[model samples]
Target: MKHYLLAVQIDETVPEPEDELREQLARTAKVSDEIKAAGAWVFAGGLLPSHASTVVRPGNGTTTMTDGPFAETKEQLGGFWVIQCEDLDEALAWADRCALACARPIEVRPFDDVV
Candidate 1:
């Protein structure tokens, strides 16, 4: 099996009520548990708002840190899951479940491994 990253994209332009946020969190947690039970879960975590992100750029043998995400977009990566899957189809299947559970768009990418 190879590793895949299932990234959850969320729109940050709109704000969610506290109650709705709690409900989605609960639903996502349930999906995480299901993924673990299926032995496909490596790890999963949610991120803070994109504004909390720091971008580091190395130049002239020095690094500068910039606040916010690298790109200006309405949607940002809100969370991600690392799972081991046989192929893209399996990864997409997991992404489908995650998208439904989290009510967000999921981007599936395979990890590079040379052996």
Candidate 2:
């Protein structure tokens, strides 16, 4: 089996309506439960807003710090799930469910097979 990351993306600044956000959260919970029951769930979590981010770069034996995300892309990684699966197809299936539940895009990537 291999581990895959099901990455969820969302806008960093737009505020979602309360009711819609509630529905999305509920749907995500349902999907999480289903994944757990199937024995495919390894771990899952949401992320804080990008404003909470900090960056550090080392130069000339000194470190410089910067606030905010590493890059200025339109979409930010809002959350993710790490799951052990047989192959990419299985991981992708799970990612599909996640995207629907979260009402956002999902990016599926398999970890390097070193096992």
Alpha carbon lDDT at 91, candidate 2: 94
Candidate 2 lDDT over residue span 1-115, tens digit each: 7899999999977889999999999999999999999999999999998888998989999999999999998899999999999888999999999999999999999988775
Cα-lDDT of candidate 2: 0.93
Q: Choose the strongest candidate by TM-score.
A: 1
For model 1, how does the per-residue alpha-carbon lDDT over 1-115 read when each residue is reduced to its tens digit? Answer: 9999999999999898899889888989998999899999899889999999999999999999999998999889999999998889999998998888888999999999975
Error of 2 at 58 (Å): 2.9
lDDT values of the candidates? 0.93, 0.93
Candidate 2 regions exceeding 4 Å error are: none
Q: Model 2, residue 43: what's the lDDT?
A: 96
Over 4 Å off, model 1: none
The Cα error of candidate 1 at residue 35, in Å, is: 0.6
Candidate 2: residue 83 Cα off by (Å): 0.6
What's the C-alpha lDDT at position 29 in model 1? 95
Clashes of 2: 0
